[model samples]
Target: MPIQQSGKRLRVPWLRKLDENDLPVTLPVFMAYCMVAGSLRSWNRIGTKTIVTLVTGDDFYYPVFAEAARFFARQIWDGQSFHGNVLQWSDKNFRHEAEALRDERAILFAPLSYQIQDDDRLLSDAVVPLGPRTIRHAEAALRRARLPITGESVELLMTEPWSRLSRAFQDRRDPLQAIQRLRSLPKAIPPAEPEAASPPSTLGLTLSDTHGFGSGLIEWGHDLAKDIADYKAAIIPWRDVENGVLISGPPGVGKTMFASILANTCKIPIIYGSASRWQEAGALDEHLKAIRASFEEAIEKAPSILFIDEIDVFGSRGETDRNSAYMRAVITALLQLLDGFERREGVVVVGACNQPDLLDSAITRPGRLDRHIAVPLPDAEARRSILKHHSGVTLCSADYKVYEMATEGMTGADIERLVRDARRSARRQSERLNGDHIIRHLRPLIKLPKAYVHALAVHEAGHALVSHEVGYAHVADITISRWRVEGDYRALGCVEYDVAADRPRTRSFFENAIAVCVAGIAAEIEVFGSFSQGAAGDDAADLNRATELATAMERAFGMGHTLAVEKFSPDAFARMRASDPELRREIHNVLATELERARSIIRMQRDAHEALVTRLVDADQISGMEVDEIIRKHRRPTVSLAKPERRVAT
Candidate 1:
């Protein structure tokens, strides 16, 4: 059969081909092959011998495969007495059995220790294939069994097999009710004596397993681990150790992973729930109920870490309109749950959000989700560590550095995905992963058009040149290369300026800084005969900073035309243009004066500026020394006055 595609769904032909070939299969093809074999016993027997095989790296799924094999053997024999042997591939007994059965027509069941090849003749021609399915199938099954469950409830039950067993053994076939009962069970079940010091308990994890996180995070994890160990040893009060933590960062910065690792390292079970899970309950009451249930579950599983991801959904009351009473109620309920944390022992709530500013202050304030930690974008060394961790294949230092440079501003998740993509590319070409493969994957993502590159080069060159000329001797580096584009601000390039050790901090210093900021636009106007939208962001940011400084000098320092030193709120300053005309005029003048100064400076240093831009365009990035050399070689020559030329009158 041919594979057919309609819209997003593809009608796969491999399964149909397997059936046509009369292949022997196991239960939950991917998860529980034994269960599937129990259901398949009613099928008519086939005369032809069949061989069944299971391939998975996970040992957890082995029992399911074994049960399925036994059930399948009984069904094929139609209740006739037949024995089956289970043996490892390397066992001498298996080798003897293989030799004796070499010419006999019989069914063989073998479970391999590694992934099977897609084109393996035995698998393609004889063994049935199975793939993993998420909760959608389980949801359908529950619905067929006349059980009431929201998609969120199904997700909760699908966490592991114990939940599934609870659902199966429920007195009343209500999944939600069963889940409630399960939550009320004693969370801290003492382990069997010998099993207490086992590998599974530790999960083979430590704070060292975390990559690309800052020292602060490492210390935080260590502190949590110590607290957990102390609590276990009855050395510290439980309440002192179970504070709610709010982790804020950009998406893909591993905020969620950090929370999970903390729980794992401390050998505590973690109850994973998100705002979306509750919201998916459909109705407002249902949403609130789901939220309550999640909290109750967390409380029941005391000594566990409850991770509430996307916590920004319960934003500040001021952020919502009066009409959004439902949202307001949800926020109130969440606040109550957070407050109730005091009554519950051993449950540490960790809330993760991309927009921490939007969260309710009451929740984030002390005594609630008090400990606020910011997970920032990874630096060069962190990027290198992230790359090394994700790149299971060998990569040299040079290759790592190249990857690091190529992935500036990218999050840890982005780096991992990039490596995965590069590996895929290498596999497609049947070659080992290399720098070329990575570069090939990254170039299209990071590279800009030549025209844009030139504009960006000119922009950064202007900033570098103006800053160097304004007595700021510390010029770090300039570049027209970047991996990511921020919102509305498509950064073509950037210039890093290192401040001089003894730089003055005065009104004149701020004015010069404003000139440096505007110089990029001035360069564009001077070189291109007009400026592009590229400088809009720089213009706004610099102008805002400059205006703030000027406004402070006038309003707070008594340096305005009136010398009245009257302090005003930020709101008042915002309305100053309409209410206080003179102050607005003064700000406009300050901005215009700095703009003209910047333009004039660019005009004077045109030759040096052009040289820098040219170098930036060619090299994409240049060091501070290279920039200084360019400026020194092309700086406007200062001509000394002809000393007493009038003496030539003799």
Candidate 2:
């Protein structure tokens, strides 16, 4: 049974010789197996009958070894005569499968999706990664078959060949299917150059007018613009000026807008590229080419800004997985390109991402994207400015403050969306856009239930009351939502605190902080006999903070039963929680103790808590001063802090 090409017999001279066994393994798959065998032989594992080989690559290649392992077993190794049994990761019971293969002289193939922690014993031998090297081998095999290699063919060969053949020739596996897939790649037409955006003079907002950006970032952009202008006038050297920065923030916080505004301020063109866009160009080789082209284009248009969005997709080299080798190559290429900009003046590289922590360290190293700026959620003033700019209106002072409060927790993009929707509604009714239009849009169509609102008010009031009494930190403000804002609406209210710069962070202070953290839940339970799900669901929720503080107290802070400090990195902290059961129990004990303390504080300040909740429900917000005045009027008793009893294992 020869493998069938389009409508004829497929012929790859080397693979044709293996047709006697009717094996379904394609040439690329065969070559990959050969590569693994070569590695095992090189390590001198010849007589070791039971071997474990872990293959890591994209999920697309899993079927090569997993589904067709029996075919591989039927075929003899080119030089080595010994054949062995094959055991795969079974969906039913992997532990059972491992046990079944233990005594037999078998070769177990674990796919990339294998859960390593569940069965660490399976990682007994070599890890065979099939990435770019595998593709290169496929290319070599194609060259041996005398196939023409063009850019389109190469792109298709790298990406589409495996995926397409896996679908089209599922039963009739053939190397000729790869060649056919490559040759059939549609040649992409070069896109025409887009007309440049309206110059800096015509852009909507100047750097000074833009809100929701870090002050340092704004100042840096202005300085760079001036430096570029000076350099054009031959008044300064490029070495004296900073050339790049990486802006990081949550999505819709105006990272992309910052780049545009910076380019407008600098009076230079901005070339935008993203990791997804580069990847869409094709596989590794083509992706690298696209990245290079972006840099070269920016250089050609000298004194321009090269903005790379979602740059974190390149990822850090420290993390290891199936994609590590591939991403390492990509990150290295980007670093070289960034270093090349040192010689080329006037190209300021600005990278943006939602997660800057995941970026390769070298990407933001000194003299590269040296200044890493975090763009935070819009502050009250910034939200006000964003509303004014987007709504294209000037409001009275009272109205300005109202809308400012109403637009709380909204990003610049969210504000713009609100304005756009409001304008649409006003136009549909044939009326001029007004504050009422914006306000109507800002408020949720279906109001939050009254019960939920009261509970939220009580929750926030509890936190504020506790913090004010503890005197550990200053209660900044308490706010409750009146508008349908973006993001997790789980948080109906929030209590912010400003810790004193010189405050002592003793064990008592930490314990007090933990009490304040659990106060919201305590407040609800005290007032309503139960609590809502608000305190526990999200990552940044109340219970998570309390748990983290409790974990830190026991594991890192040396404030718990143990005197020795066991330091762990952020990643290691998560692993410690999973591995150490006793540590978890100790953390539970800390939380339970603090939760009781929070309940006591809430009980003592019941009158003050009730008054504050009423005020918050009425105002939908209260200032720090207003909160203090309410607590004063309620005549709260002084809060007494006592040491908590820890449980001892008998």
Candidate 3:
């Protein structure tokens, strides 16, 4: 008999069939039997305390079958009584609980296993035996469930995708060949859409079209493509080819999109998969099988790109022991597959992850995921390119430029979302897409709350004013808006100053920069009567810079009162402060002196500061030229105060 029925002579057909000698049990038959038994027990007004135990060998089907039993129980009993437990025979603690469950007449659900023992021997009276599903039983279940199998007739059931089969069938060691015999029996109905249709390719996109990537990245891609072309044309040897590239960056920086585009540019098919997909199988062996299948498919489709998204999921060792052995085995299999790529030509493995730091060193070692590409946030120019790419033609060049400036520090994906939002706004208004519509939609996304706008304007205005006074000639821009809202929306504003990339560094330079950093806090104290936490970020950073400069002046440059150059450890510095009160006094004096200097600078240019703050509050952003115009209009050059002389080494 397919199902081993004991104890009761249930009237269910499948169970009755099990009483006969000729019946062959299968997964679907077992599932149907459980469903019918649960429903009959409820219909016949069987006591709610009755127990049912299901036994099977396939671990993957344990949960599914147990859930099926409970679902039918609830539907028929109206939720009065239905409890199910899906236990694996391999669970280490199963033996401890099995006897107690048997004593309490608890319904046990398990897959058939040769190693069944202990309390399993006690449930012999109520045991229900389930076996591999036959094609007929599998089809009946699908028909009852109203699910569509592929267009293939009954004869092709064995040749259909494994996804259509039960876990029992999928768990087979040789599933493909095992299903072949079922193909000779009959014809099947065609599906409306072919399941085998290829997904849309992204080959048309080029590196130039994908903004926010650096020039070096674009060049590398071009070189890789060239090498592939050269190899195809016999211009380069196979061994000279680049193997694989690992792309790492913050999320939404276009790593996956770049992979697709790269594959398209290289004129190769891309096979994409992720660890999460393999993890859905719910068993260690099944996950490994899926991983092997994906690699095998990639190898079979040579001249292809294998793009693994979120590769960090297979993190370094010691992450989890729940599946440590399985994870290590999976990683081992992956290592082997990656090594195999060297012997095979035309296949490139691209692994993209947000946390490359968490990945195992072995996975990213030489010759395996070798090339590392970082996709950084878009700079102003790249933002311009991305904005223009996503904006409608209705938006003029000037509009694109303005939006680009506003979108500073945004990623290509963020820009795309902004453009999409703008388009949606335009569509809702039933008006032509234009700059005004885009800005209207974009403002709320990038602007701060109304209460903080004035303070932010004051804060950034102070930095701009101080930077100009300290000889930072090129103040790029200042704004009370952000390109993106970070955690908790605490950031109020920013000041962008252009410093020469190769400028010389000196004590005076560091001092001026420190003053500029603290100017915001100084402005808040001077204007708002008391400072808020708004200045905490700037104050802490500026104070750290000032402290570092003071430490360097005393220890490294021999610029302190004592000429002896000596580096002090943190503990030594703390001791020096405690023992020599004057040393602590000197550091405090330097920072206080810088802060007072910034305050004086702001005080001297009070009119320009007010005008700039007003403009910033009203306009939300102002360019360097606008700032210069404001300061130039309100110029009142006062007699400069004599600076304090530095303490020279005795």
Candidate 4:
């Protein structure tokens, strides 16, 4: 093979010789190359194929291919005749060069982002996808290039070479443009001044001031904070206490804020980290080092909160993909750092994520982030309270009721954003923050057609009437929005019910639950000619709930024909439903049976249903007490709405 450059003879003035420990390549980029080194070395040892494909996500990393090739030529091939180059799609001779590489022992950097045929000889099972680079890599690049590390310099690192100082390096044909535009920036940034003292009441952000339920985490934090402050070690030892919890929820539900509140309440320092942050340290060993450092720091500052956001990034050891090897090693190191030989007595770890199921089971096992709590979207009452806090002004009860209805299905963060945007709007107009200001952000409510409002009322009335009649659950209130709030339609209609926690998950119990779920569909058919698409929509839509419960009865709860239970997860159950015709039929049968049952219940209570619908249409909302009175006034003597039980053949 003809060598393009002899490593021993090729000398350059701009670049210096790198020592064994020195890495001229960015850590992440270097780590990527190191990933494929083993396979290449294995081939070298066996004297088999020598052409290896390095797949990259973009051309931004193209500049580093030469530095890597040069470094590896000396380090791995030991200055032996070596040739390496990127087979870019942009090159006119891409096909010719690719064909030429077939007879040569070389490393080819190829961009997979470009369209390429799979049958191409250069595409192989040994393809290595380029690893990602973060701001951490940018910092490392600066140090390697012997440039001053400043905020402005780091910004330049992220810019395209042609747009900045990198063009100078490119003009000189120098590929290592790690310095970027640093030469134009000040060598150092000046120190910042300290802030003024805050009021005693404003010690820090508190859970007390925050809205929405914490699923008992907030209460637990308060208790722990009190005990720690009082030094009640005898009454509640650290060993005996539940030290950690994993919180999961959709974004803006305050997973990160939960940690902040815990730190504030406990009056302890909070150390933040994530798997991505740890992995940014570079390879598996570097990731392990970062993980250990985080834990060690938390331990040093005892009685602290170590919040690991996006802990799901560690993934599970059960994964069988290529990155599984790295995942297993990182997860194992994390486990050790979390609960190893060294006693971490005073530090409490909290893990937060948007998806809890994606987390490694070991990470959430008994001794670590054991307790899992999912933060739900704020309900009406929660929405009201959240508005009050963010609005920073007292409003009449009626105003709050309107605000709550407008903001339904919104998370805490969503509500906060609404309020912030409303205030900004108000400021722009130089007017006082009023209902008009908030309404502007939410957009003016568009009144639904009279016929549609009447239908919605009847549908919601069905839920309340059936729920109250069943006596299995307590109907709190029922509401139907006369106008649809722009951008958000979830608050169109709702029936609030309180079911006892002790209620058994028996066949009869689930049947009644399913009946409540489908009552709207049944009610619409009874009152109107037919039901509309209103019953089937969002995940929380009535029809969806009925279908899920019906499916679970047969497939999961073992309440149907067979006692044999099949384990169910949201995804797994969905796949089963999609693939299995018999299972889908069974689920449909359950729904049909329950739908009929709901229709029968509603048919018997027609007078009460009419009265409820009249009240709902007139008021657009009604209390449970009013519904109870209406039901009592119109009840027939022979009617029974209690949960039905199966009877033996007589």
Which lDDT tens digits does candidate 4 get at residues 85-108?
A: 334443315444555365455565
Q: Write the per-residue lDDT of candidate 3 for residues 1-650, one digit (tens) a residue.
A: 59864433343433333333422323343444444453345232433343445565432334345444544444334343333333344442554355435433234555444466756656433555543444554454444333454444333433443322332232221233223323321112223343332333444897766768777677888887888788889988867888677888766677878888887788777888776566654456777888778777777887678888878768666445334676787787778778854354677888988768758778888878888888787887777677667774445677665666556555676777777777888899897767787776554344446767788788889889888877744789986763334322335477888997765455666667767877887888789866666453321344544665666565556656667765544324544555777777777777788889989888888898999999998898899999999988996787643242345567
Error (Å) of candidate 3 at residue 197 is 12
The predicted structure with the larger lDDT, 2 or 4, is 2
- Candidate ranking under lDDT, highest first, comes to 2, 4, 3, 1
For residues 363-402, write the lDDT of model 2, one tens digit per residue.
8998789898899888988887888887876667877766
Model 1: residues with Cα > 4 Å off, grouped in runs: 1-205, 320-323, 340-344, 396-402, 419-440, 443-457, 465-477, 482-490, 497-513, 526-528, 537-590, 603-650
Query: Model 3: residues >4 Å from true position, as ranges?
Result: 1-200, 212-214, 318-345, 377-392, 397-454, 461-492, 497-519, 535-650
Provide the TM-score for each candidate, comma-separated: 0.53, 0.62, 0.50, 0.65
The digit string of per-residue lDDT tens for model 1 on 277-308 reads 57655446767888888778888877788889
Better of 3 and 4 by lDDT: 4
Pairs that collide in candidate 1 are 27-32, 27-33, 28-32, 34-68, 303-346
**Global lDDT scores for all candidate models:** 0.62, 0.68, 0.63, 0.67
Model 2 residue 386 distance off true place after TM-score fit, in angstroms? 4.4
Per-candidate count of clashing residue pairs (backbone under 3 Å): 5, 0, 10, 0
TM-score winner between candidates 3 and 4: 4
Which one is best on lDDT?
Answer: 2
Return the candidate ranking by TM-score, descending.
4, 2, 1, 3
